[model samples]
Target chain A: MKIYIHTKFQESIYQQFRDGLEPKYEVIFGDGEVSESLKEQFLTCDICYGNVPLDWLNTSSQLKWLQLNSTGLDPYQQLTEYQFQLTNLKGFFGQSVAETTLAGILAVYRRIDELTRLQTKNEWVGTPIRETLHLLHKAKVVILGSGAIGLKTKQLLSGFECKTTVLNSKTISQLADYLPTTDILIATLPETKETIGLINKTYLDMLKPSALFVNVGRGSAVDESALIEILKEEKILGAVLDVTEIEPLPTESPLWNLPNVLLTQHSSGGWAEESAEKVVFFLNNLAHFEKGEELVNNVDLVKGY
Target chain B: MKIYIHTKFQESIYQQFRDGLEPKYEVIFGDGEVSESLKEQFLTCDICYGNVPLDWLNTSSQLKWLQLNSTGLDPYQQLTEYQFQLTNLKGFFGQSVAETTLAGILAVYRRIDELTRLQTKNEWVGTPIRETLHLLHKAKVVILGSGAIGLKTKQLLSGFECKTTVLNSKTISQLADYLPTTDILIATLPETKETIGLINKTYLDMLKPSALFVNVGRGSAVDESALIEILKEEKILGAVLDVTEIEPLPTESPLWNLPNVLLTQHSSGGWAEESAEKVVFFLNNLAHFEKGEELVNNVDLVKGY
Candidate 1:
């Protein structure tokens, strides 16, 4: 059986992935970018790791399984039909993303941004800055989605004694009620038909004036223009946006200059061992696949998760 | 019957303290300064709710109790004799200080410092910065002291799945064994005779090159010059210094301009309701004092905790 590896990992990570695979299988590696040669090679493989071009998968009759490197299935949601079994990196990113969310919230609450700025100037505004500092302890937090990321975030917040409310499709209707009292509003929803534009201007306006908005989910889940407008007007305290409406955030975007806003630039689900870990996850799932067993994190294309 | 309030709380906090006291008791509010008026009032008071001058307390024949607003009894450690029953605000700053320590550590681990700097320049070095990002999850941690601040720090670190070892005076001898493998080192010890200059050059040199040092304890607990030398040489990853040896640190201090050092300027024990909460603590302790009950957080001057 032939396997096509299409991941942009470092050389050592690729070597680790190659060493983990059974030596009997024929393997071809792509550098995560689609080319004429990659497309020809991808079509001949029975198994593929990493996200291959959807069009290539659509035409390939040999492809039996395709494992995605990403958790979000936004791009593949529109696919009506495919022969390959689709699995995503769902639970793997939970801890990393949750830690980043907590980092952003804590940085805001503890006045870390202000302190960092002060440190640059060698200014010590000691006693005066005290009153402006906040605490995550006993904060009222409302987290959107009940997926791995949201659940992990709730677990971390529990350690701080935060009163966290997890809202998903089932409890999303009550988000308006929670927003008025929420000290921190976090969105970790995937990009689905229902989730897109869910956090529009109306819901944004419902948030407490002192509430901190955090989005580690897909950018489409929120209305970026509405969020930007409210943030500009100081309708809400501030925001920690790991994912924004556009990648690179267009250098001219107001979010870059916004006083209280912290743009993590979609680096939340990252760590030193991110690629190596992903390779391991792929290899583990590949072992199960070779044994003709049901794979984990099989995405239901119709449900669009 | 006379109670002298010598705290630099806001007018509202002083009013809160006044309102909480019994109507029959005489109350005199001071601006937390040693003036002729305050000294005269301090000498006549039967009770005090702040850290008064040591000489004034020594000579005050009428003084009965002194409730210090500070958690550390650094100055009082030298007092050979006193008539008053002294109590410091121990355990009161646990949550606040712990949150700040976590905030600083998380800020470094998740690259909040780098992201914040990038946000200022409207620079989005997204994928490139991913390799530099780290996680607090599963890191080996070492915490100094077993007081409320240290215990609280450990409790918070548990949420990150960090393997935390707490070393008090009894367990401090084992610190050298842990430092070589520690990813994060936190000091929350008070300024006692035993704790002073505990984190010397030798101990700091034992830490891993990737270790992050955090100090929410008294600055005297660490040898500032040694810490500065190591940080300048990049012997350790970075440091979060909440309490430095000098207030407003010196204008020429390298700590202010150090690449990765986060100086919080001794504001860790602050929150929005800090002053108000202190007043409530003082009032509760006053009730105990009035009833001839053993006051909470009673400090032993000789032991210097």
Candidate 2:
């Protein structure tokens, strides 16, 4: 078997995985002109791993699995477009995304946005707003996507004295028990055919009126226009978005102007290597998979992990 | 026994605590403009419940004990200038202040400051930075002042899979076991004779260059001049200050202009009704103490807790 790795990571991560497969597998570095432009050049390889978007996948034949160095599947949602199996680096970032999700809740609940503005204006507005400050202890938290990231966030919030829950593709009745009571809606899901635009007005309506919403997963998971409407109407307290449907939310977009909204450029995941190790972990399993062995985090490409 | 309640939270909170404390305690509402001063109106009572600065009690002769409605003692530290039995509200705000401390840490760590600025400029930086996301797990966190607020923050951070540690007026060999390696420094001490200027240049020099510092207890606890020197020197990653020695940090102060600094007006503990309730609890407890019962949260003026 032959495998190729293309990403900016500590070589030790790749070496750790390769040592397990031994002489049965051959590894090659995919870094340069030939690797990116002409996928046909690597037709002999059995596995390839990188965070390349669908558009950059010049070819995918002979590639048994395409391991992504990220949790969300927005870049590879249309699996049919790719010739090989697609699996994401999901579990590796649960802690970071979970930490960021809690960070968002704290940002809004504590009025980080308002205070930051006041700092720049040199104005001191220190009145205690019971309505806002009380959110931390008694909030009903909703986590969309009950994956490792969502569950980890739930666990963290549970300790902060908040009521927490999650939403998934299938009405996992177990997860549903947690959502209706949600006062804070957190999106920590991967983008899929069923998840895109899941946060329409109807979904937003499920949240408590002053509920806080934070998105750290994929932008397409939310309907940006609906989110804007919700904030303008004061439907929910506000939203903190690290991910949005479009990158660099257009300058003209209402999201940039809403007082209740908080927009971040989706910088929640740890720097590159952290995500790379997650991907490599699954790839090393594939070598054993070729030799008839059980896999650790084998994502069923058809079902999507 | 008669008790003068000088705090605004005296009414409702007393009612709430009334059900929980011994009966026969009469509650007085003194959060108003009475022709009589705190000394004139409260001399008849055996105990006074208030945030009365020592200056206000200079003319009083019957103040056996004075219970404060705050964690810090700066307001009462100069009491030697007047004579009164004293106690302060120290543990009531553990949850709120701890949450605020965490909020400041998250804001600085996740760069909520940059996010707010980008909203106005319509920039999407979260996505590009996603590859470099920071996770708090195994992080080194240093919290100054292991009082109620710091203890509560350490508990909350403990659940996040991070390293936690504390520094106070004196080294606690027992607490040293719970302290993490110190990736971030969170200050939750009052501005008083001992704590003023505690986060001086010599103290900050003990931290990692990537460390972030957050202060929610008192502005003067941290030396603003030394902080400016550290920030200008880029000794740490960033800082978040809720209280400044001077309210509304001077616009001319370079601390306000630091790219990584976040200055919030002292609003962390200003959560209205709940805040009032906490104060009231102190008042009711003072009422109980006046009746010759043990006082709840009685501050030891000599120990400065």
Residue-pair clashes per prediction, in order, are 0, 22
Per-residue error at A229 for model 2, in Å? Answer: 2.3
DockQ of each model against the real complex? 0.82, 0.51
Chain A (alone) TM-scores for all candidate structures: 0.97, 0.78
lDDT string for model 1 (A1-305, tens) is 89998977788987897788778888888988889888999899998888877778768999899899899775777688887899999988999899999999989989999999888888889988889889898999999989999999998887788899999999899988888899999999988778889999999999888899999998888999999999999999899999998897999888899997998999999988899888888888888898899998898898775
Regions more than 4 Å wrong, model 2: A1-37, A51-60, A74-86, A127-132, A167-181, A272-296, B1-48, B62-65, B80-85, B167-181, B191-194, B279-283, B286-291
Provide the lDDT at B216 for model 2. Answer: 81
Candidate 2 clashes: the total is: 22
The TM-score of chain B in candidate 1 is 0.97
Candidate topping DockQ = 1
Q: Clash pairs of candidate 1?
A: none
